[model samples]
Target: IVDRIDDNKDGYLTTEELKNWIKRVQKRYIYENVAKVWKDYDLNKDDKIAWEEYKQATYGYYLEEFQDATDQHSFKKMLPRDERRFKTADLDGDLAATREEFTAFLHPEEFEHMKNIVVLETLEDIDKNEDGFVDQDEYIADMFANEEGGPEPDWVITEREQFADFRDINKDGKMDKEEIQQWILPQDYDHALAEARHLVYESDVDKDQKLTKEEVLDNWNMFVGSQATNYGEDLTRNHDE
Candidate 1:
């Protein structure tokens, strides 16, 4: 519009802008991050950046984060899944994920591995600011957890208070890790390992194949699974009298 080449200002440029700086200039501006501010202000495309039809397009989240998903699954993941999923879930137009919507739908259980990596006490601790919700970054740090002093600091937490906090979901001081995991994510968890992470023996726990079975599932529910039967058996056998 500033260039006045479109003259009509119908949101899209004419052949002049297309054949010239339109593509080159738009890309340059987008890359420089100047256009990031006015991202949703497409001024023409109803606030959605349809890059393919564009000559140089100026919006999109960082794509590389999900590049691996594209290689293994579908290229459509290159864009935000929420953008599309939002329309389906919000077919009625309210802009929030409701309880009915939440229970009816589900977050991906793809990375069961994450649960093992993210411990219960660690999660409770991460809600440190006491926000009741934990973010991905807080989940990464062992901050919500005290270093396990009795034995493995990296793998476990030795603090009694911390462990107690794990069971006390409402911070009410009652249940336990098993109860917490059960009430939080899974709908009908029962067995000890029911809510644990499903880790492949070859890939994890026995990363170097040295730790005893007790050490494997001993850390968190996320790392233990039926698939890890051998590792679990080893752990159970270790406890045998």
Candidate 2:
């Protein structure tokens, strides 16, 4: 029996070691079957399973045993790595992303940060335009976007919940910049605002100095510091393996 305790005695099942008990009968499977079920499997991009997102993606597999899930690799390939792909995912074309748009666009890791922004925060604060999903450019303009994510991006039940408590300022189910700044810089709210605004304002070549979609997104990389961006680095063509 696999015997590494999932918990260090928290009485709840967490901190469990997954790889130890993972029985692999893995192999490459049919592409069509997998593509039809694209959202089913493929939780984090490392291309493995047994996480919350994995379960959600492959809901039909809940009843099916993992050993029998698939005998081969069925995934078509990573997301298309192109400006168009980003645009399609962004939808609003703002550059920075709100929770909804971010989740849909990011590789597994980035979504963790996306979810954190809206965890329990008042929807009124960050949901500025009331479009359900805030535009990314506006997100950058506000610096509501920050360097926050989970150790394991693919897992829905992650450390992100801890950070969630920060966003819900009014306890009304949304995050306002004012509340977020509290967690971000402690007693330095004005400092945080000034620095973030500088990114857009200072970078503008025109005297207008307002954030352009591209200019705002240009610095998104600096905020989220992860290196596991393997969205087909070598396989640029996006073909089935």
Candidate 3:
């Protein structure tokens, strides 16, 4: 792992190298997950998963058992949501998805082209009133639940201010689709880079900005983390058995 991450052959891992490695690991995980799901959903073996195939394979039981139900938590509700996402992912509007499209369907946040879908989905989730916009109350409710009616925490207050100042970009008292996109998918922040920097900061015991193999291996769990471990578990699992 260290050898692969040490891009310059300088026996040290720079922040950029670590960040790139993390990004690669995340993409690999997404690809492997897409492959597994595709194998399950692509019943016709035609290298494409049609909407009906996925819907039947996933929600057929609900369709058969609760066809008339339309509760908030019902599979009936989920069907429409999933269909909307599926249609968004189907770039050609063919009601089907290739592996690349399936990847976008599963992980819309990872693709630039799928950002609109991501924003739409987020709006759908948080905009319970369905007014085509997310108001401040809905935005705060999405992250916090003050069920006890107790005093608000400092963070909650900060988040309210954040919503008013940063999230409501147009001062419209609500977030439209564009504002929602900017809030959820901020262009300035790189999550992988931030995480890599944090890991290096925690593990770099020698006060150096870069990481040696020894430093990284000593904090192995911090570097490999749960996501990578889960991916390894998937890789080692024998489905044929």
Candidate 4:
């Protein structure tokens, strides 16, 4: 990814190169997420999601079973907000959201409410006991359920350790609202900004705000493992291929 963005082929990623790479990363993120949302919610196979279908999929069928007052309140509040969003996205007011509108509606950067909804849904799924928190067991079980049938992967074990170490900040062995927020959206986690800053910080050995091939090679592992680097694995694999 860094090499491709080094458009001048001068063995360095300048500010312009970093900016372009960030744009590509943002585009890829939006494209993949939009496709996933469409696939999951576009019921009736109409290539678009109508208001009713979206409501059914989001609000779920067992609304009455929401014994938790918080969950019930959240769901009720979400209904009108989602309705308004649907109407807003329905550019022609056709009571349906096309892929484009739905994509816009689901953009996490642009629509915070939608992002919250997504986060809440994720919490609900993982918080099986409905205790408004996710315990270590709950997290582990959810991960295993999503994976293919086999013994849990080593990565899952590592993730469990990470959750206990980083996510359970209070040492309570459970994740509450603040912890969950940290898990979902770590502080100052703007991927594009972080990536650009990290590339320059790691590779600009001369403090010139640009990378050279020698500098990048010197810190290759940083690019591969650092959260600040996007598409690093793909770039590595492409090089190998």
Candidate 5:
């Protein structure tokens, strides 16, 4: 990873280079997922997946008679949701999805054009009253349970203040679609840059605001989770008998 991201070839990983590497990794995951799932749905192998093709591929099992009524009910609910998302992602309105459109459909949060859909979906999930807006109580309830009938935690109080002071930008008691979008997908936030900076901050023992290959390797666990090291699989398989 260090060798791939060290763009300057000065044996150091700068913040920008690391951020680019992380962004590349994210894109790679998206592309790989799309590739793995495309062949299953694109039965004709013409490089485009039609709406009928997708519906049959995904919901054929539900169409079978062996499924229970509860399963049928779930399929009925999910079918329209999937249709809406598929149509939104089909930019050409041809009712078919190319590789790019399929990517957008599968991971709408990764694309700027799909952000409104993301915001709308979030509101639909959180706005219990269906009033087309999210009030303070709804926002708090989404994050905290308080099932014990006890006083709110300090962090919950801080979040409520955050919602009033920052999230509800127009000082409205409730958050409209625009405010919900801003709250969830702030334009100023760069996830890759933030993660890169955090890794450097935690791993750069020399305090030079950059990282050497040795530093990254020394803090490998901090850079990546157990997936990279096989630590999780090993722990599960090698537990005391």
Candidate 6:
């Protein structure tokens, strides 16, 4: 992600480059959501949704069936967020959201609250014993659930190692809140900042606050490896054309 955004090829991402990279990532995030939102809410296949359509589609039978406290709380919170988003997206106050307006409403980097929800969902799926945490066994089992009979894949092994070395702080053989926080945001530890800071920190070798191609090459493993960096796969999968 950083390399592709380094437009001058100076091996470092300036503030402007980082901003551009963030914009691209945000756009991708919004793009992915566009189809999903439309599919679920555009009941008439009109490619546009009014507030009532969105409300009905989102809160209809499917969601109402899961009326647990968590689900209820999530639904409650969603309304306000969506309302704000709708107002932002409804550029002409047309009381309807077009695809373009809906896209405009989504701010990807500002979705840290959603990240917590995702983490909770993942914990729910992986915590087989319902113990409120995931042990190494549970983590590995969930990650490699699709594998048939072969030895674990290299990526899975690397993830296991990371689970122990990085995520298992205090060596309790399980993850805790602090560890998960570190896992999510390791650097300045601020989830709101652009993720490009992490890439810059890894490759900036000279203490001059900038990087060279050689510096990036030297840290290739850190940039490419799954366990080492959060943005690696995103960079690889969404590289600029």
* Tens-digit lDDT string for candidate 2 (16-90): 121211111011122333444444444454343223444355343433434543432232211122223334445
Candidate 6: tens digits of C-alpha lDDT, residues 1-241: 5457687887665645655656665556667768766777777877778877877877765466875988888888677666756665577888787887666555422444344444554566678888888788887887688557778789988999989987888899987555665665464653223445665676778766666667767887765652222346574564343
Q: What is the C-alpha RMSD of each candidate to the true structure, in Å?
A: 25.4, 22.1, 3.6, 9.2, 5.3, 9.4
* Colliding pairs, model 3: none
C-alpha RMSD between model 5 and the true structure: 5.3
Best by the TM-score measure? 5
Return the candidate ranking by TM-score, descending.
5, 3, 4, 6, 1, 2
Residue runs of model 1 more than 4 Å from their true location after superposition: 1-43, 47-80, 88-151, 154-164, 167-241
Judge candidate 2 at residue 121 and give its lDDT: 33
For model 6, the stretches where C-alpha displacement exceeds 4 angstroms are 1-3, 10-15, 62-85, 104-198, 221-230, 235-241
lDDT of 1: 0.36
**Deviation (Å) of 118 in candidate 1:** 16
Instruction: State the lDDT at 193 in candidate 4.
Output: 73
Give a tens-digit lDDT track for model 5, residues 70-96: 889988977888899999999999999
TM-score of 1: 0.21
Q: lDDT (0-100) at residue 217 of candidate 1?
A: 35
For model 2 the TM-score comes to 0.18
lDDT per residue (tens digit) for residues 67-173 in model 4 = 88888987997788678667765677888888877876676444554545556656877998999999998988876765567777898889899889988999998
| Ordering by lDDT | 5, 3, 4, 6, 1, 2
Q: Score every model by TM-score.
A: 0.21, 0.18, 0.86, 0.57, 0.88, 0.48
Candidate 4 residue pairs that clash: none
Model 4 regions lying over 4 Å from their true place: 64-70, 111-198, 225-228, 231-241
Model 1 agreement with the true structure over 71-99: per-residue lDDT tens digits: 53543442334344333433344543332
**Residue 121 in model 5: lDDT:** 89
